[model samples]
Target: MSEAQNPNATLSVAILSGKGGVGKTNLALNLSYALFRAGHRILLMDFDVGLANVDVLLGLSPEKNLQDLFRPDVTAEEVVLAVEPGGFDFLPAASGVPEMLEMDDDMREVLFHKLNKVFGSYDYLMLDLGAGISQTILSVAAMSQLRVLVVTPEPTSLTDSYAVIKVLHTQYGITDFHIIVNQVEGPADTQATFTRLSTACNHFLGFEPILLGGVRSDPALPAAVRRQIPLLRHAPRSPAAQDIVNGAVKLHRVRQQRQQALVDAPVLGKIPIIRK
Candidate 1:
């Protein structure tokens, strides 16, 4: 995607939300599949830690997870699972894993180190981060090349999302953010929501976020989730599925633009998240 991109270049994006239950993980899972379908090697990490449920969403009971990577005999590759129907690699951390719930700073570094060897094997890596602005979320997010903020039309969702943007900007100096409006009933109202969020961001944070796309409110989405099938796999023609594909395309384009920019600007090297 870059101008004759570096062979080892792997663009990492953090998929996060301000609060839970906004379908952030669902978006992350499907969007990665869309890109993987388009022929890019994709890897998804269920970084929600204690509440990890990506494996559950796919009805997968993995033999190993992020926790297993810490085991002396378990390597990072062994902990990674090859997800079916999506054809992408997944790193799952099951729910109720107390160690994952309370990862110390050293654990974070070790986890990253264990996975860094495998990062170059993929074209993109999606970090399905936990909701809110926890230090665990922010530190890993700050290391990513881009962050896509998922939101809904609810008033509380908007407020909490703004709080996330504020903290990322003020604390970490992260100004660029892409937005995806989920659960949209129509384009007009969706645009209004994005406008409201963007206005607050531009006025207060001094930066306007980019709108990737909006996912329609579709019953089929929940139905597919309930059945433990991916939206694209269970209902490929569904409106929500199509919306996710569209958003993935837009996201791919943004990555391409950023890649080209890095080529032209020498100092814009890949942000190293796995430093020794």
Candidate 2:
């Protein structure tokens, strides 16, 4: 939300995780909704490619999807679905399209170009990246302005996050990253998990990741999923919903502060402002 992230430049963040089924999409949907509620124009992209589910999470059945963008005469605007009353639009990935997982560099370039054209009108572009660290997902991660890595409390989840971190460092040379601990039973559990991840990154990756905060395991999240609406809209008072709202506020505040700094200082050392 830094001044650098004004209407002239859109702040793009990719919500990702090394492991699947850790509520990556869930957090992304509500988080974007929270930002939208805060009056930011957001364009959410379902980068899950062939296994896209953001639309499903919203209980939407779009006639034209990401696949339609690849058609001979289709424009990116034609396939984007508008999530009304919230000021957020989305470009849903095509489910059951195997080719999405195997896009070449050329196709990837095309995708980014089209996305860039459509993204110009928005203030924030949030990408719900697919699970796992494949070439496609990694490429998207490397290209995005901010990367929000989600992981659970389990050891396997930690290991997978570490692996993804290793890949990002080795391949993209990216060091500025954020982590969100999801499904935490309590604060102590969240701290322990965060500490373990911090220690792993320090000892192994030679970098420190900012802890963006945690979300308690709440039944309302899944219930909202069942109802095909975001928890923020469906169960605003629930703990999970509250946590996401707070996180989005924090994110918004951070961006705003950064924006102010950029405006006042012109060039504030080397801290990179997340943008395309």
Candidate 3:
């Protein structure tokens, strides 16, 4: 089945980062829960491939993952695991599986088709991509409607994040990006970090990224992770969790505005002539 044939319109977001240990996956997991709480049907895909950890974070032991898609008899629906309590579904990836890391063009297309077929029912499909820019990462990023770059206050994180943006913009022609500065000290730090990054991008890459906001460095976040649960569920009142909720709301509003602009756009065609 094709995407156009599906009645529901799904907005796909890829949560990516330039380096690991920046809390990208954690944000993705919590943001998924946040969106679900807002009454949207969400699907989270652990597209981190060989380093997949969504199942570990959720304390789930799924029998199937992306590897199962390679099997002739298995379908995409069979590989999806639903997270209890949060009620959002996720397609887990196999960790440390060397073979799963490499996919040719044919395999990639097949996987894309499978996901497209099963994702129509979802209002939002969030892909928790692995850190760094790779062939696999680029493929998924290109496929997604929104690419969110998760970064931190560290200098290395900022540099790496800029490199990823440069590659995507110069090579793939991806101009618009949504950025979330994670693990920050305060709003001042967040704004400062965003300003620096945006200024650099505008100066070098010629395109400024949209700041979706920042996630503060909350102790509750790490504690919740250690307990193998989403921050939103483990500590609903935590600052980090609240940040995710706020980010989700902002994302929805941005999407709505873009859709409205498209709807209100003028159509182009040749003017018809009238006869006397």
Candidate 4:
């Protein structure tokens, strides 16, 4: 397969968290939007299968979702929708489906087979993964080229985020964690929060995660969410939105570096994938 049909060029980035209410999904959505605005072909996959809400956040009602992709007749291209106003491809997941939550290895193989067909088409595959460490999430995070750990300033948030980092590092030797401190007060607060997490990682894991950037606490962020609008689209000038846009700029450069490295390096194996 050429780069368009394989994983050689496309950069898969999974934005994840250790716990809920840390604004993982929201940042995933906006950062993808910001990158799209920055002239990249982005495909934002809502991997929070059972409780998926990317569609709800974007105010989209897709006729086909990730659930439909599992059906033999349904293709990822068929289910993937073009996000309006934001102008990126979106692969939405089913919400409140019990069986989708308890996905087995067989089901995952089916999903990987389906997704592999479309992975090569985008410049960046922004995966909004489910919170906490599950088998499926662990595998996905491990396989992704970039694992973005979104954390807040709270002690519990840092603790849980460290737990995630430790698990992924121990299991798969994933050391390139890009940390983004969301809802921060300012640069000082962001540094403080990152220092705390970095200290823990350096002391225990012998690695420190890169501080990508921080999203300051902005009321417009929640308002955008409430109104079902992308923060970039809603209030691009807002503090949180600007922070995300800045992060996207840094992310774009990193992605270009990684993509070239992937092309020059060996190809990733077919899924079910993990242990990178």
> Highest lDDT among the candidates is held by which one?
4
Write one digit per residue (lDDT tens) for candidate 1, span 195-276.
9999999999899989999999999989888998789988999999999999999988887777755333322133334322
Give lDDT per model, in order. Answer: 0.83, 0.81, 0.82, 0.85
Which rank order by lDDT, best down to worst?
A: 4, 1, 3, 2
- RMSD per candidate (Å) reads 3.9, 4.6, 7.6, 2.9
In candidate 3, stretches whose alpha carbon ends up further than 4 angstroms from where it belongs are: 1-6, 85-87, 260-276
TM-score, candidate 2, is 0.90
Query: Once superposed on the true structure, which residue ranges of model 2 sit more than 4 Å away at CA?
Result: 1-7, 260-276
Per-residue lDDT of candidate 3, residues 1-276 (tens digit): 433223345677889999999999999999889888887778899989869999989998999989788777889989988785444888999888776676767877667667666776666788999988886786677667788999999999999999888877776777879999999988898999989989999999788999999999999988988999999989999888888999999998876766544232211111122122
Query: Per-residue lDDT for 32-104 in model 2, tens only?
Result: 9998988888888898985799999998988888777777688898888899655688888887778788788
What TM-score fits each model? 0.90, 0.90, 0.90, 0.92
User: Which wins on TM-score, candidate 3 or candidate 4?
Assistant: 4
Clashing pairs in 4: none
- Model 1 scores worst on lDDT over the 10 consecutive residues at 262-271
**Global CA lDDT computed for model 4:** 0.85
Quote the lDDT for 92 in model 1.
Answer: 91
Distance from true location, Cα of 22 in model 1, Å: 0.8
